[model samples]
Target: MDFGVAAEDEAFRVEARGWLGEHVGAVTERRAWERALGAGGWIGLGWGEGGYGNRTASLTQQVVWAEEYARAGAPPRCGHIGEKLLAPTLVAHGTAEQKARFLPPIAAGDELWCQGYSEPGAGSDLAGVRTRAVREGASYRITGQKIWTSLAHEADWCFVLARSEAGTRRHQGLSFLLVPMDQPGRIEVRPIRQMTGTSDFNEVFFDGAYARVEHVVGGEGNGWRVAMSLLGFERGVSTLAQQTGFAQELARVVRTARETGAVRDPVVRDGLVRLWAELRVMRWNALRTLGSTGDAGAPSVAKLLWGGWHQRLGELAVRVRGAAGGVGPVAWSASAPYEMDADQHLFLFSRADTIYGGSDEVQRTIIAERVLGLPLEPKGDMG
Candidate 1:
């Protein structure tokens, strides 16, 4: 496939670059970026032309928007659950009425959404999710717990995967439901703190969460299929935005080290070089996946590589800064301590990158079985 941008893509890129240059500022804080994205319509840059997007735009146009926005120091949209994962899945599976009701708010950033697929006992084996949604006349009463839900505290609604039928096989009984977080007895969000000393992720308790029958995205027994589609989008389309942002951060780290004379040290130089090479490979792999001409397993490969690269870059930033890094205030300032704190936070957070979006081991397993055509591992005996 021709990776080069067509004339239309180039025009779109120019337009995006111009728009970002006018509206974007030097804000690096995640919360600030979220608000800015909501105001600027950069959060949903593929919905329509009136809202900083052209709905008929090509995927290349979307890629250009992501690249330009990231280059301009804008936070990637994946940080927002609604715009990144749920919205796209809704577009693909939601009924026309559902789309009309949900898509506009998500596009406008007026509503936030979260994923409710992973439960206490189910993560990598998503089919094992046991959250039950029993149909009661006009509504379904959902009763279960969802763990590791990112931004659940801030979410307006959740797209949940629940067991609608008990006797059926694990994958056969599930259904996708859209539960309104604000409704009575619907969601009880409890913040879960991370190693970064932040509580962005949460555990949500659905105690008789009442959702209308019409809230189901797809029909019963289709949750597995819908979830698979969402995961593919998460790994493939989302990584493009993430890789671009990481590449920019890597460049910033390198530039900071050089300007600060830290690159004079051989060890620092070597670490930086290694990270740079890995970052380049990640960028290339992500682009390949986004282009849709690469191996079908490219997303798994990209996620694995990116997880490793994030840790490596974080480590290099610390080493390059040395002892001066730990002395500054936590906020983003021009001091060495500030930079060090940022790197330290990133280093701590990077540890979760491998674990969150299906762990590295899971990705490797997928590659070996699907791409390399390896024999499947036998299931362990629970008895």
Candidate 2:
């Protein structure tokens, strides 16, 4: 692939860079920042593929936006689950009314969404979901628990996968339902404190939570297909932004090594150079696989490459810091008694990099069976 940007895409990069440099520093509030992006037409960069009516950027332009967004040092997006994942799915499989009703608020940044897919028992094996939704007159009542739900405490709505029909097993009889989170007694969110001393991930409970029948996407019993489609969307332009963030983190680690004289050590120097080169490979791989949705294993390959790469980067972050990495810096007294420094936080948090989303083993299994035509691994009891 030619790495050079087209003339038009270069223009878009300049525009995005200028806007982000001006506004990203000024907006610190999460929801307000989302609104500013929405008003500035920065959200929903790829709705046109599904024919949703928005100013659609080409795939390369999407890459430009994500790269610029990351390079601008903007805060982590609080509304990405809605804007990137759900909006595309709705356009692909939702009813006209569903699209018309939900897409506007998402683009406007008026609503926030969380995913309710991973359960305590069904995280990596998503088809093992046990959450059930019982249909009533005009609505379905959801009852079960979802663990490791990011942004659950702040979300206004959640798209859940639940067993909606009796006698269903594995991926069968499941429905994708969008349930609101404002029902006081029916829903509860408990935070999951990470080793990094933050609670951005949550455990969410649904006790007879209601969702309108119209809110179900891809119809009842077709949730597996819809959910898989959402997974495909995970490899969109956002991966470019992710790589950009990785570049920034690696830069910090390189600076740390230089400042502390760690670069003088042969091992440390080798690690730093390798990380820098591998990041470029990842960027190229991401660019190569951007629009190749026909390749079932591309996403898994991408996942496997970056997941372990990030974990190694985390290790290097601490290695360069030496014994000093063990000490936690007082970065946030309000949230926890002690806070981890940048290196400490990176080391601790990225331990989960290979575990969440799709575990390393799971991604490899996808590549083995789907890409290489290898025999599938035999199923075993979870017990």
Candidate 3:
């Protein structure tokens, strides 16, 4: 529980800072950041050129990389699904051949990956997914629709959960398959623009998509386990990077408000104080989850708390920005775009924070039943 970094970790942090200073530059554009990651190995910092990462490095080292990258004004690596969720999952569950085929491009940022977990019918209730993949000779013909697929429109591949066996329990008979997005007659993707007017998420359609049997990660009927493992990583490590970025943005917002004299107002001061307190709590909570004594249930709680705070912070930013908070084109300046200002765009996007990954209500249910050992909520009959 020592929050202080060890001497070794300090050295690692110094080295990481030096490396980032040399290779990374301030890039406010998200696309430019992605390209920078590809050019540098910063995107998959600890990961090997192949599927493995520097296992010798402590978790503290990974945190160092994340923090230093953020300080350098580089977008955190979690912005891409390949580095955040898919790579680690692949390292754990992918076959040797599968790893050989996929890992390099992801490490190099030559390929992008997206998650095809949520559907029109199944989101928080992931086990209820109705997407089907029938076995056909040496391949599986996948046919289903996925929604909330972030970056699917630009992704080179997707890790999808499909019902490989029908008529079984919702959780059972599922498999995790890797489908190539460029393959013909197999996939269609349409962008789902948010209120922010940016299409970061998409609706992906799989029409008899052909995937080789070897494309399955882990194994058939083991998708539930693999997916659970992946979600654990998603909630833990992935969420850590995101919270770091949020905290950075929070700091930036505070500075902006102060410079603009918005902080002089009582209401603005109160909002900033509240946000600061919440940010501290979030950082501590996230550290606990990412630390050695981290618990499985901690992430569920962290996600819930962090997501709510993100939304609140965005609201506070909007209030601070006033008329400037409105979404529209902005005149270019040397600094960050006013249109891309934290309060407006972030506030709009925060609306979906609780909805994506897992809803706040869903996380609370998990904490209640699983963590607190409470009685399960009564289910409504669809029949």
Residue lDDT tens for model 2, 1-383: 58667897888998899999899879899999988888888888888854443467988898898889999899899989999999999988999999989988888888999999999999999988999999999999999999999999999999999999977788789999999999999999999987676899999999999999999999999999999999889877899899999999999999988888888999988988898898899889888878986888889988888888998898888887783344333234676655567877887788898999989999999899999999999865432
lDDT of 3 by residue, 214-278 (tens): 99999998999999888876765545566678877788788878877778889888988888898
TM-score: which is higher, 1 or 2? Answer: 2
Lowest-scoring 10 consecutive residues by lDDT in candidate 1? 47-56
- List the candidate 3 regions with Cα displacement exceeding 4 Å: 26-40, 43-51, 54-56, 76-79, 291-294, 323-340, 379-383
Candidate 1 — which residues are off by over 4 angstroms? 25-54, 75-79, 259-261, 291-294, 323-340, 380-383
What is the C-alpha local distance difference test score of each model? 0.74, 0.88, 0.76
Better by lDDT, candidate 3 or 2: 2
Candidate 2 clashes between residue pairs 3 or more apart in a chain or in different chains: none
Residue 223 Cα positional deviation in candidate 2, in Å, after optimal superposition: 0.5
Query: In what order do the candidates fall by TM-score, top score first?
Result: 2, 3, 1
- Across 210-229, the per-residue lDDT of candidate 1 in tens digits comes to 88898888776788888887
Model 2 RMSD vs true structure: 2.3
